[model samples]
Target chain A: METGTVTTANPLNVKAKKESKSKEIARKLLRSWTGVIGFSLIILLLILSIFGEVIAPFDPMDAQLRDRLLPPLTDGHLLGTDQLGRDILSRVIVGARVSVVIGLSTVLLAGLIGTIVGVIAGYYRGWIDIVLMRIVDVQLSFPFILLVLVISAVLGAGLTNIVISLALAGWVIFARVIRSEVLALREKEFITAAIATGVPKLQILVRHILPNIFTPIIILGSLQIGTYIIAEASVSFLGFGVQPPTAAWGNMLDEGKDYIFNSWWLITFPGIAIILTALGVNLFGDWLRDTLDPELKGE
Target chain B: MSDILLEIKDLGIQFNTGKGPIQPIRGVSFSLKSGETLGVVGESGSGKSVTSLAVMGLLPEKKSKIVSGSIHFNDEDITKLSEKQYRKLRGNEMSMIFQEPMTSLNPVFTIGELLSEPLKQHKKMSKKERKEAIINVLKQVGIPRAEQIINEYPHQLSGGMRQRVMISLALLCEPKLLICDEPTTALDVTIQAQILELMKEIKAEKNMSLLFITHDLGVVAEMCDRVVVMYAGEIVEVAEINELFDQPLHPYTQGLIHSRPTNNSRKSALYSIKGQVPRPEEIGIGCTFANRCPHAFEKCLKETPPIFEKGDHLSKCWLQDSKRQAVMK
Candidate 1:
């Protein structure tokens, strides 16, 4: 009996030790070089986006023809001006807000809709699954860019319209990913246990199914943000995304097209901003996927 | 019997596929008296798990349907009960634990949250009351660090620990009926013994009717008061545990007992039953077991056998008929 008590208490101590060791591993992971770089880049981009108005040397829309096409570090314009004489630096700074806002909104709306549809299709799995999955199939069949162009043309170009169209286009991927995940998740013994316990169907979906599929949802969502930022840039470049004078990264790239040869800085700076931000996001998302994966967590 | 806790009569379950309706369980029936632990033992495709699911009203809604049946619990017919009505009884009056303890719990929820769920839904206990109750039950189930373990998620625990948590979850509502479907199949032998011990202790204390389903006959011998032996979706024999071991009536039961590896036979070739269980589509009009039965006769092939009774034991075979037994003697 004494030995039994001692053995039982020892496991508790071991568990406590294991818990603290995991925390240490987490700390060690964040202290790695890639983690520091990725973290800093994301933090820096967020601050610039949120504080764009205060930090911009000039109003992003301000125009002075005399400063037009001036090279970087010329006079007050730190990054010079575009053909419209708008401060390139200010526009790039302000453009981060549009990318982040559109990216986040598109993902959130798409994620919510997809998760609901996927959960229903995966859980109930009869006519509802057939119809919902067929719809997803129909959405996936179309050329994505063509679909976006068609929707943008019908809705007319504006920020809200861009957001709405991207959401519509983006939700299919989320639905497909989440549906596949939930299909596997619903088969787990926990779900049967939940049903046997008489947890309400809705409660089971929310509390059991949703939480179990979150790992995939989060990884997919993080990766999609970077993709959506690029997607928004592409649509705006084609004149079917955010309208002109709004200083979206895509529109900036659009306006810089004519001055590609003479004023290379027009496209160069905004292009770097998009590339760097996308790179940072991708790096961070990849890191998260690896870190959260149980298979990889040991290393 | 007047004291019968649950009665299932003529339970027929069918799964409709693209080809046609495939019946898995045809006319399977049994009754459980109060505080009795009834073991339903069968091979893999014998429909033992399906019977338990039918009782819980948790069969897959799309593919499967209870074709014809009546399930009475405490004198109330539950066959026609709506899902909402079942909810009040489920997890309150009855609950279930399943196999594969490693994957039988939601990965994200802490043990405390999962265990407290039935209490929150059925008992309407306050947060403090629920916590204390949860801790007490965890301790009752022999979890050493109830408070610490409560905060831990399922993945953090070992397989045995998870199963213990599952048993605790099933017992939280003090359910009158507990359906355990191969609950220890996924655990190692040592853990299996421990879980069985825990279950025996708890069942004795609570006096709930346990419907224990397993493929292992040894488990039935150890845990059951009475045992039902199913073959090809039909009950072939039913008897008290000791009676079953003493004189198994049906050929399948006899075959099952013969296949057990006795200590003296360790160096000799083991006895095994011949032929696989026929697929549902392959089953013909006559007795489903006729194709596999060693005692199969012209009548056994030409007609389905009604259950033949002798004293308190029953066997579904022509050989069990008194006239046939008398003639053979």
Candidate 2:
């Protein structure tokens, strides 16, 4: 713009720019203590899920009647023992695998399905839009958890059923969110530019516009991980979740309810585990959403 | 005489709506010979752009349609081409630069990406070749730090840089016909001149025919060799640039010239036309501008004057006959 000193245009020198943008996103992510703390908790749980078997002092399925209902500060049971005589510490640690796997895979499947459905509906529009939206409408009419309950019951209850059920329950959020995003994005001049350049519609979606909306998806996905965990726990507690011997916190709670009055440690510890894991994921998601907002991008 | 590169004859476009359909341009005709510039000047709703867009096949079909038209480019009816074929023609044979450069360039993409897209699309150049072409286009457009700006997003650059980027993108393919729909309107005055200069340079370098659409008569004076002054979706006057400015035929043309402020002049309250542009619903049966014309007579009110040409100039008014009668006397 300042005339005279016009330098040569080099398109390939974009690596520095892309690197800086990524750094900016990372810097923004780390700006808050809450974001860092939430991130650490999620990471810690993920690590435990990955290596819980290697680290658990006693096998997650092992029980000792002699050690049953041991309170905190007892030897052998790190936190305490549940009414089932299973080590509560070991079970809570092992529950991370089910919760993380279900939460992540549900969101992954839902986000993939919903984003495709939404993009196709929004991009092509007209009859496709009407049909897809009508489907969305039909899906929306049912209470989500009830729908999940029916689905899991039909599929016969297991960890996989909970994953499929949670995926069915949550896919609508992505369909709605991404449909609107696509609607807005499709009309921009860049789209026309892309069209002029003969960029395929699918490429435009996956490459150009998808990157722009990923932050919101990540934020929402992270937040929903917590909700999915809680949902999985609820399903398990209702006798519709993991089929025992897995040491999922929800089933632990189901077994612990009998000892709730005399031996509160049984229900208390698993309940706390569920609460902490959900709280951790939700906090991280919220922080991610806040920081990723374009308005808050700079200093 | 130059060869006819883009020939458009009797082009009519309209918009379909709940109220049936509205005819924006009844029938418009124009042509762009190779290496020629045609300045289409008019008030906002004069169908100047609608006509160009119809020729380019870029109409937003939601509320618009080309009910009837034949656009001949390189001795072929472009209107008959499929959307895919039309796209093939757009960036390769004919590229368009839109008025708002900011909106025209994608904010998410780097200028380099935008500049190199057409090169890769039509030219099929490898990355290194495309990179060099992008930088060359940017340098030609007079963007300093073309390399730096190439990596920069649209938001990172100033308005002028964005406009230059738009220009670079347009010229990247070196199309034969550049349909610039008021490309300089959103720029600053100094930047406007710079863009105009850059456009002229590009036009000459590529030997491309340019269809420069604008409402500013001043720009017509500076950039056009021939001019078409439109009023209410009709071509009221067309002539060589010098003759059109010197002996303006249409009352609309006269009004536009008088409306421009001049240096060291009384300005005479800067004459403006008495009425607003006729809404499509309010248009009368005869001459669309009859109600607003100062020299309108009974005949002018009842009849639409056909275009009468003398040499390369044409005037659509009853005054030509009267002037001829006076000359005979």
Which segments of model 1 are wrong by more than 4 Å?
A1-37, A57-59, A73-78, A294-299
Q: How many residue pairs of model 1 clash at the backbone?
A: 0
Candidate 2 overall lDDT versus native: 0.80
Per-residue lDDT of A299 in model 1: 67
lDDT string for model 1 (B222-261, tens) is: 8999999998888999999999999998999999988998
For model 2, what is the alpha-carbon lDDT of residue A180? 88
Model 2 residue A41 lDDT score: 89
Candidate 2 lDDT by residue in tens digits, B1-329:
33998876777777886777778886677777899899999889988878877777767756787677688998889888887788787777887778887777766667776676777668867777777888888899899877677766787788888888887887888888888889889998999998999889888988989999998888988898898888887788889999988999888888888788788667567768888878666666777888889987776788788787787888788766666559658
The number of the candidate with the highest TM-score is 1
For candidate 2, write residues A163-229 as lDDT tens digits: 9888887788788888888888888776665665555557778767776677667777888788888
Worst 10 residues of 2 chain B by lDDT: B319-328
Q: Given candidate 2, what's the lDDT at residue A169?
A: 76
Native contact fraction (fnat) of model 1: 0.67
